[model samples]
Target: MPTYPAFRIHQDAQGHHAGIEQLPRPTPAAGEVLIRVGWSGVNYKDALAGTGRGKILRTFPLVGGADAAGVVEQSAHPCYQNGEAVVVTGWGLTHDHDGGFAGYLCCPAEWLVPIPDGLDPRRAGIFGTAGLTAALAVHRMLVNGQEPGLGPILVTGASGGVGAMAVAILARLGFSVSAVSGKPELTDWLRHLGAAEVLPREALAGATRPLEKARWGGAVDNVGGELLAQITRTIAPGGNIAAIGLVGGHELHTTVMPFILRGASLLGCNSVDIPYPLRRTLWNHLASDWQPPDLEALVSETVALEGLPPVFEDMLAGRTHGRVLVAL
Candidate 1:
């Protein structure tokens, strides 16, 4: 019904760029609803998409956030009502569709999950996709029979959004968490997130053997490549490794020794294309028991819609930590 500010990312004849611009209000389609976005969370992928780093955008001139929380502005769907709070993540919001880096977002009702009673919009935005992936990793680990009694659980990239949340959730669920980070300065920060110990990047990178001594019961690895390959080798018998991100590198140089001898399982986590029902369940857990105790501390910054460029640079350069929220 009205025009609003939106941050659109695009690649043109000039080059790739993104900026805040005025956009017409979106109209809800059949089985869809429109949300007046209150808060949107920034992820590494979002940063990449915003800055046109990895061709993250399937189509250009799109809003540049994947996760958002807000109140329903209008609805033609049975599952949602006007003025109701909702959270949206995954379902290809930022890549193929208009995303939350706007004052409003219109999407299928199926993509919207009612913001749980206990959580506020800011809290939901803080957790966002990062918390969802953490929950997925934990859920997969549990389904694979990961147990605290087995040994310590390892979380790689433990100062990042998903890794930090994973450490907190796993530690809360009675597992002893050993977190690894390249930034030795974040050791205390990781400890505050419930890590029993913080290991330097060197500790996780020195495994020359195809199969090293078993140390962790399981691992939630957000950095792929060498770190994931190393985790695959050192996991205890029957341990599962949830390999999530490919920030370090995408290639894995490892033999099948860990899988055959140790029976370690390598599970790939896809937060973007998960089924809607399961995604809703993860959101519920994020609002309940899996919610991070120090969520506020994990939020490194909150920027306005117009202040996204420098944020993107910081993330791509690996200078950012924790979650960054965008107030819409």
Candidate 2:
């Protein structure tokens, strides 16, 4: 069997370690397709899995890319054909199964989303899981009665991949976007990405009131803990908040006053395990009107497989911004 370079995570008596290694190339099994990966992206979960900071991987000795875009090299599944363009997000790519931090990937065909017209593999990978989650969050907010005319939408963690994409998408959809970020230097960048206003992280810091001044008409919250609690309390009546990440903390301390008195809704957004139909719909939207303008601006850096170690370190340390595309 031929061999290929792959980034794998392993554990032993010493400690958990992840690095690039030569591994046998994978072949398509029943209901599977072999993909020649062109691009992948570094997400927060990928950082956790690669660095062994969080128990993100269900198994060891696994590749650690949660998002991949490429061309199909072979297919044992009836739906996929050779040379087809496709992208995969979530679906346990870096958890229980071999992932796309490699030259090739063999995954279930049903997990693949065909790259829609006007979107290439590289751009799709740039969007990747983070972009998908952002789009999903916005979608859920809209479904829950959010609209451009409602009021300004707030996006927390605005400098991160998901938050940045959320801001751009919401702005493109004609919503006034208010972004919150800890990095003061990124204020201009956030506004350039379509944020009507940029607020410091302290805006949501500290203890949150059960209910406060009605501010945001809707919000896409990537930071949990006290930040989420504050957002929930401040949302306008009947507004929705899509809670997407727990980077701050997981424990949500708040009362039901926002829900009972103000009729606020907290919508949990999960990109992982989203059904194929909805995934396709979201991807299609991304490839269409929801696509951010000047996506190249969102890419903070592009690195090769061998460079993933430092990238993961930067992500975990909060030293990186926007999306980091990995060219395989």
Worst 10 residues of 2 by lDDT: 203-212
What would the TM-scores of all predictions be? 0.98, 0.98
Error of 2 at 242 (Å): 0.2
lDDT of 1 by residue, 1-328 (tens): 5799999987889898789989999789899999999999889989889988787888878988999899999999988999899999988788899889999999999888899977988899999989888999999989889999889999998988999999999988999999999898888888998999999888876787988999999999998988888888899999999999998899999999999999999988998887878888888888888877777988889999878889889988989899889998
TM-score of 2: 0.98
- lDDT of every model, 2 decimals: 0.90, 0.91
Clashing pairs in 2: none
Q: Residue 317 of candidate 1: its Cα lDDT?
A: 91
- Quick one: best lDDT, which candidate? 2
Candidate 2 per-residue lDDT over residues 1-328, each given as its tens digit: 8998899999778799889899887778799999999999999989999989889888778988998899999999988889999999998798899888999999999899999997999999989999999999988988888987768999999999999999999998999999999999999999999999999988765446677788889899898988888888888988999999998899998899989998889999999989999999999999999998888889999999989999999999999999999999
Model 1's lDDT to the true fold? 0.90
* CA displacement after TM-score superposition, residue 324 of candidate 1 (Å): 0.7
Instruction: Determine which window of 10 residues in candidate 1 has minimal summed lDDT.
Output: 286-295
